[model samples]
Target: MAVKKKLAVLFIVDLIIIWFSIYSAYYFRFEGKLVEPYVNQMFLYCAISSVLCGACMAYFGMYRKMWQYASISEMFAMCQAVAIGWALSYAAASVLSEVRVPLAVAVRTLETSLLLVGGVRVIWRVIRLRQSSGMDKRIPTLIYGAGDCGALVAREFKGAAMADHKLIGFVDDARDKLHLTIHGLPVLGNRTDLSTLVEVFKIKEIIIAIPSVPRSQVSEIINLCMASGVQIKIIPAINDLIKGKISVNAIRNVDVEDLLGRDPVHADLQGIADYVHNKVVLVTGAGGSIGSELCRQVASFAPDKLLLLGHGENSIYTIEMELKHKYPGMLFEPIIADIQDRKRIEEVFDTYRPQVVFHAAAHKHVPLMEKNPAEAVKNNVFGTQNVADCADKYGTERFVLVSSDKAVNPTSVMGATKRIAEMYVQSLNASSRTRFASVRFGNVLGSRGSVIPAFKAQIARGGPVTVTDPQMVRYFMTIPEAVQLVIQAGAISQGGEIFILDMGEPVQILKLAEDLIRLSGYEPYIDIPIHFTGIREGEKLFEELLTAEEGATKTQHARIYIGKPEVIQQEDLYVELQKLNNVVLGNSEDLKDVIVQLVPLFARVS
Candidate 1:
């Protein structure tokens, strides 16, 4: 209704302008003395001009545009509409009127009408901008880049919805752009000047609008802003921008993932698509962090069908709904079955005959698995054996197991089981036609039981955040980064090889806790105390990506390396598994000892 009223008002105003323009043209041409014949035909000329011009304006969608956010395209449209309207109006007047309208008068009328019509919109847009930006309470904000993305951010802030923010200017690093103006906002200075600028301008908010740069650079800027004690926001990642365009709604708070100081992962797109496209892909534990991310990335390649298999019904249902919503046209089948149940696993394999299998189902939490060693073996060892055997039986082309850095010289029951799982797949690959491999990486930053969420929860409670140990350190990567490399590893796998991802650097738990505290707007040990608890059972000071016995060699990808495959005696592995199976079924207590025989590097934490 408001739009209708606004359009009606604009139409009435345009009609009046059309009539006034014709009269003005004649007044200017006859030196303020109106000629008799022109005056007599003025009413007929006005009627013809108003009707034709109004129709042209409607056809050009002039009244439909939100002039408050007008651009050059809107002005161009207005010019075209006015010119076409007058051309048609002149033709009609020459044919239907007794006196011929002067050619000079016709041209002058078009020029006058265009100026008045276009001027009204431009003035309205300027007035709206002034009214919105005139807010006295709007927070003074500074955009951290003066490039394309920064200019886009400035443009979005001009809307009424963003009236709460008053853009001061941009801060750019390029020497040439340092003093230039972008979108009428000046480029203040580089990152080093942030603190002084914040103090001088009393800047309450700083928006990091440099989305195309490396995250490390962003992290550096964020740290600089941290010293300014101002609220900081960042634009979405380059790929996350909608259709490669930024919106003010997409501005978000900086996350711990950004603090990792790593660039976005670049996967071998064609390689992954080649194997995954049109193939029946199956992801075990598809509801879990790594598994769900795998499903999302794989869905992009347009798989024939993505089988989401998990033990928990709720988790499986959640992922199924998500996939269905995200990839509506793609086929997705959510299966609720346990990998530990051999029959159920076999049934799923027989039904789908999935060409690509990503085995991510396993017991992973170190402390929990320490207390429940037998369950860990049942799921991580025997469960994996069941999946791999089915893959072999069903003639699957490729099978990739999601292993962990803990699997190397494992100190925990969980890690030992994962190591044992890796061994089984390697042994199976020797005889099976399927290419079996494993992707081993360190701790996923935001996985279900990872330390990141624990720190956040403690911080939210306004108390001491707990750290396992001050000295304990582990390599960390975001969940998406890990899953991307996992898929890429699958694309480049040969049978029996274990691929290790480059988990940038080992981060100390103490430093990580401090960073999290600062990111949460609290000073460590001052605002939020950090307490160090001794390391838990089955955890180590550091995790190794590869055991000394299995040295690594560089792969085709810079971030991936191939660990030398260990030769496993197939008969010996079978006998040990049989004994372990008996121990589990008999409820025996020697589970850890039996696991030692399978993974010789297993070191009992006790």
Candidate 2:
């Protein structure tokens, strides 16, 4: 009903405009005097112009446009409608009446009509701006980039019906754009002037709208903005943007991922596709963080069939539904079977006979696994054996174990179990027809039970965020980056090689917590307090990607390297595994000693 009323009002207004434009054109063409048949045909001329102009305006979508946000495109559309209407009306008036309307009157009418139609929309837009400007005093905000993205963001704020922000100006790095007005907002100056502008304008928010630049550049800008002590928001990188259009709601608070300062991982697409494309691939622990991402990335390569196998039925069902929705034409098989069940594992292998396998299932929490050493052994060590033996028995082409940096010279049962899993896969590669390898990396951001989520939860509760130790440090990677390198490792694996991802400089845990607090719009130690809890059982002050005994050699890819650790004899490894199995089955308290026998480098910490 509102639309209909708007259409009716606009149509009536446009009709009046057309009639007045025709009469004024004729009066002006006659030099302020109306006479004879030309004066007599003025009403006929007005009627013809009104009918043709109204039809052309509707045809050109003039009535459909929201005049409140009228722009250059709308002006161009109005011009086209007016020009076509005047031409048609001139032809119709000449044929319908004996006294022909003069050519000057027709041309003058076209000019007058275009001017009136476009002016009215602009006036309406100005009136709306005046009304909305007085509606409320919005927060003074500054956009960080003056490029295409920044301009779009500024326009959104200026043109919105009830925008909560008032765009003060833009601060760009490009010197050429400085002092120029964009969308009625000035390009105040470059980044060096950001602090001064914020203070002068009493700015409340700084929006980083440069999406396509390098992460290091963004980090630099963010660090500068942090000095100003205002809320910081961002337009996500181009890769992160939604497909169709960017909205004001898409402007989000800066996240820890943005602070990582790591550029996107450029995987060898052809290499990954060669191994994953059109192959039957299986991913264990498909409901967990790494496993689920593996499924998403593998599906993008158009695999013949994707097998999502996990012990948890809900996780399996979730990834299965996501894959089905994401890849509507591809086939997916969700198997709810634990890797520890040897019979169920073999049955799955016999049934699907997947060409490639990514074994990600494990018990990985450090302190929890320290208390539950036997369960870690049962799942991480023996469970890996069950999957590897089945892969070998079923003739799978490649098997990649998702190992961890904690596996290097471990201190905890979880680390030792992962190290054992890597050693077992390496020993099996020597004798099995199926190729086996391990990919080792550090903590993935936003994973289940990771420090980032824990810190976020603590911060959300508006209390003291707890840290394990003031000096604790750990390397981190985004989940997609880790998974991409994992798949690439599978492509380049030549059996028994442990691939170590190039995790950048380790981040200090205390500093990370402080940054999180700041990113949440709070000052560390003042607004949100940090509490230091002593390091828990089975954790390290620092994590190593490769042990000293297993030095890394460069691989073809820059971000991935190979660690040729010393391998154990197949019979000796199985004998040790048998001993570990007995300890776990007997529920012996001395499980750590047995784990140490298998992994001599493990320095057990009480």
Candidate 3:
């Protein structure tokens, strides 16, 4: 109703604008003397000019736009309408041999029309600004981090009732930026002054602006903001901040994923789309973080067939069922099979002949894999070889293995096994007819065993939230974003390329746990106990995405990087692999040695 009324009011104003434009144009062109001769007949000229002006405006589409989102297109249309209307008025007086108004009338009318239209728009917007000022004034928002995203958040509130969040200042990670102003919002101080800044500004909300900052840092800021009894909001990732494609609607609240401290990498969208579009694609571990996300994105590109393969009955069935419901026509198969078993994998591959494959199945728990290295080898190493070999044997076109940052300078058996698997896939690509690739990234935001869930569960249980070590930090990425990039890498891949998806920065685990505790409407370390547990065996202070010996060259995609490593002969690696396979259980003592030999950087923790 408000929208309709506003439009109706605008319609009457548009009519008045058209009349005034032509009348003023005549008055300015013909000085006082020209008007004196035809002064008595002026009322008739005015009436005719008004009718002509209305017609010109209608023809030029002057009333079709709304002022709020109205753009240059409408302004241009108004210019054209004024031109036509004023020109017609001058021509009628000259041609009809009646009241003669000079041509300058048209130019004056043009200027008047522009001012009237533009001024009214600015005035209307200003009126709305004043009306919303109280609400905007009520909530003084302090945005943390002074970057491009921070500047955008400040702009969002200044124009309209969008978020109604009044910009106060910025609280950043570096003290060097303390006195800097972004988009007119001052950078009050570094993160240390959060409590004081909140009180001083009477901040009602804190918006996080640094999308590139490690999740640990983001979490710490969120905790500080929350502790002051103020709400916290986080800007969306770079992809969501797409220029002009999206509006302030995308400037959203801080999510659980943000605290996980993960960032997105670039994926070769066209390459991935080409391979998956209209082709049969199968992903193992379908219900897990990576698999489910792969399914979600694959469905959008119109695949002819999709196979959700996983051992866990519930996970497979749920993801398969969900994808099927969303994409009704696509042929989706939910397969229950252990990737480690030769016969079962053989059966699935032969029956499906899936064109593209993403082997996501693995035993990724570090400490668990450390304790039971056998399971890690069987699942991560042997399972991967089985999938890749079968994909080659069955004439499947592409096979992309999902690897981890732990695989770089690995400390745990899980990382070692993954590294070994990467070697086999790379080695196999050299000789095999099928193209195989590996996507190595870091820990995902909300995977089955990620720290975010653990923290949330601990925080919910009340009291102690456990952290492995305050100093321990790891690179992270959002599962969905990582999965999209993984699929993209798979689509673009040809032959044996090892792509390391960029995981932005490392974040401390303790800060993450503390932030999660605070975001849940609690005071950190006081309302929630943070229990410090010593680092687990085979766990290190940090994980690496690239080994010291290896260097990376980024792909056309910003997030996807290719690692240059010396390629080994597939025949030689096969011989060593065969001996290890024969003594999978018998050589437990030498297993660690064999793994390090296979992956030179697969170091054990001190």
lDDT tens digits, residue span 320-423, model 3:
78887888888888899999998999999999898998888888899988778878888888998888889999988899899988888788888889888989
Query: What is candidate 2's lDDT per residue for 1-606, written digit by digit as tens?
Result: 897797688788888888888889988888879887887688888888888878898999988888877888989888999889888988999888778888888888887777877888888889978887677478889999988888778777866642778788899988899889999889999988888999999998999999999888897888789778888999987854554356877788998888787788888999999998999999999999999999999999999999999999988899899989989999999999988899999999999999999999999999999888888999999899999999998999999999999999999899999999999999999988988999999999999999999999999999699998999999999999999999999999989999999997898999889888888889889999999999999999999999888898999999999996685898988899999899889999888888888988999787
List where candidate 2 sits over 4 angstroms from the true fold: 1-135, 239-250
Question: What's the lDDT for all of these models?
Answer: 0.90, 0.90, 0.77
Tens digits of per-residue lDDT for model 1 on 1-606?
998898799899999999999988888888889767788677778999888989999999998888989999999999999999999999898778888888988989998898999999988899988987574688999999887788888988988878898889989889999889888889999988988999998898999988889888888888788778788899857765665467677899877787778877889999999999999999999999899899999999999999999988998899889889998999999999999899999999999999999999888999999998889989999999999999999999999999999999999999999998999999999999999999999998899989999999999999699988889999999999999999999999978999999988788889888878877888888999988789999999998999888899998899999999988999999999999999988878888888888787898766
* Candidate 2 TM-score versus the reference: 0.76
What would the TM-score be for candidate 1 when compared with the true structure?
Answer: 0.75
Misplaced by over 4 Å in model 1 are 1-136, 239-245
**What residue pairs clash in candidate 1, if any at all?**
none
| Model 2: colliding residue pairs | none
Per-candidate clashes, comma-separated? 0, 0, 3
